[model samples]
Target: MRMGLVYGCAAEDMVTGLTIQCKRWKPVYYNPTKSAFLGVSPTTLDQHLVQYKRWSEGLFQIFLSKYCPKIYGHGKISFGAQIGYCLFLLWAPVALPTLYYVVIPALSLLHGVPLFPKVFGLWFLPYAYAFFAKTAYCLIEDLSSGNTLNGWWNSQRMWVIR
Candidate 1:
């Protein structure tokens, strides 16, 4: 990890770097750091949009690159941890497919059409529940960590952009 500084949008590249290091050699003791003095500087909505775009784009770039989690991260970490980390890493790219699915239901509603044939049998329910469950889990974690209303609101806004 010390060979290079992998800092970029949302720190996705940094995560890859650290994961690779961990795969090669486990740390005897790992200390995750936080800063009480650190805070995000408030900016205009346009600036926030630009920042989000940059972050997602950076993550997407990493996803497309040779350093992708599946390519370099699979055997390095525990299987479950690797899967979870890859899912998190792929979040931004997955947003496009998620948007398509959501928009179809929205468009069907707008057009006053049935969501699907009654016999179609809610096949998407499990997937929807998984998404919701993950979201709720993250929100609960954030709240338990003393997140403020502004922090929650900001995170929601960023999620929408994603």
Candidate 2:
């Protein structure tokens, strides 16, 4: 199980790197007008990006078992990054309120930790929002979404409302 997770994480990283590479080179890619100066054409550049994106996104997905240490520890990279990222983002929406509103009384009266009401109060809303937002976007892209830029931008939009 451990080795399998590691290999999957590595594969996820490679795919992610490939996507980044394609995105990085997007502007520099040949265009008929621009490439004519050198010797290539836009079609070739488009084709190249298409190939790279196809290979990467065709199998694209994040790994969560991303284990590194500081970088992190043994874990699934895709699952770890996406869901984990959601964890923190969702956390932000609640952390402040929990501290001021619930943590103190709960910790003092209950065990060493915040009470269920305190924890639950902070947990559900942000979590549900993040989950739906991320899931909808992921599912939409996985099936059919030719506008890669839009897909990427929308996914990013999850972090910020605007």
Candidate 3:
């Protein structure tokens, strides 16, 4: 079935909804790589922020309104794929995890709180190493793949919009 299409900076909600609906009802295989690739505009940073804000607000509105993947996604998708999509949805708004996992722990040490205890403290070494390693890996992957600028731009666009 051919679905009527809709998309714009302000139309993410509709686009997102249509995608889920199509995925739910259509038996045809859907390849995300074959989906639309947009070329966003805004020569100035201020204008970029304006567009970003509009898109972010729309996405957040979708998330809040039960059109999100986890809610409407249901049996239309596999559980693991649904979880992955949900994580993507949460990536923008879950800033507190960054603060909780990274910032608060560092600040606590500065305040003379015992950063770790005697027995389980050793876990911190592995945890910190894993965190750093994952971060470095992502950075290296982005740079090596020549996605650095694009990744940074998308991140910047999402940051303020979230």
Candidate 4:
């Protein structure tokens, strides 16, 4: 049977690639000394956000549909591949928790309600550690990937926006 790119998806490339992988075909990656392809990136924040939203929604749609990696990919793909697909596909649903974390804390603070333990409390230690560790890890990862501090900050901002 002949295989082609899947249609009717905002992220057709991603859907097609996932489908191909599920068909037990291994993909090849070739990295040469020179650039192989050039593409234009979204120039403005609006354009970037729009593109991101579309891609994320498409991934979420797949997750909700029968094509979910954990569902359709079961037995067809390796465990690690299914996990990797799930991580990317779950991006949109992650926004709900992010929203709750951002908005609830602020609203609680505004109402003089403490949503977390005091800084000196034992429970605070875990929260503090998690926050600092995640921040540090993200910073290190961004820097290691050749991104500047500003770039890391911008990525964090974009994460919240998305």
lDDT of 1 by residue, 1-162 (tens): 444445554666556465556557544444346646466854777888777667666766666666666776766666776566567667677878988988999999999998854544687677677888987887888888778767887888767755
lDDT of 3 by residue, 1-162 (tens): 455454553546455554656466553555465547566667677897777667556766666666666777777767886666666555447756765768777898889886664545776787678868976776777677556667866754655443
Model 2 lDDT tens row, 37-143: 46553245457555544433333333223322213322433444444443432333444665665557766677666343443577667767887898777767744
TM-score of 2: 0.21
TM-score of each: 0.63, 0.21, 0.54, 0.76
lDDT ranking, best first: 4, 1, 3, 2
Clashing pairs in 1: none
Poorest stretch of ten by lDDT in candidate 1:
26-35
Clashing pairs in 3: none
51 in model 3: Cα distance from truth in Å?
6.1
Which residue runs of candidate 2 sit more than 4 Å off their true CA positions?
A: 1-123, 145-162
Candidate 1's displacement at residue 151, Å, is: 2.4
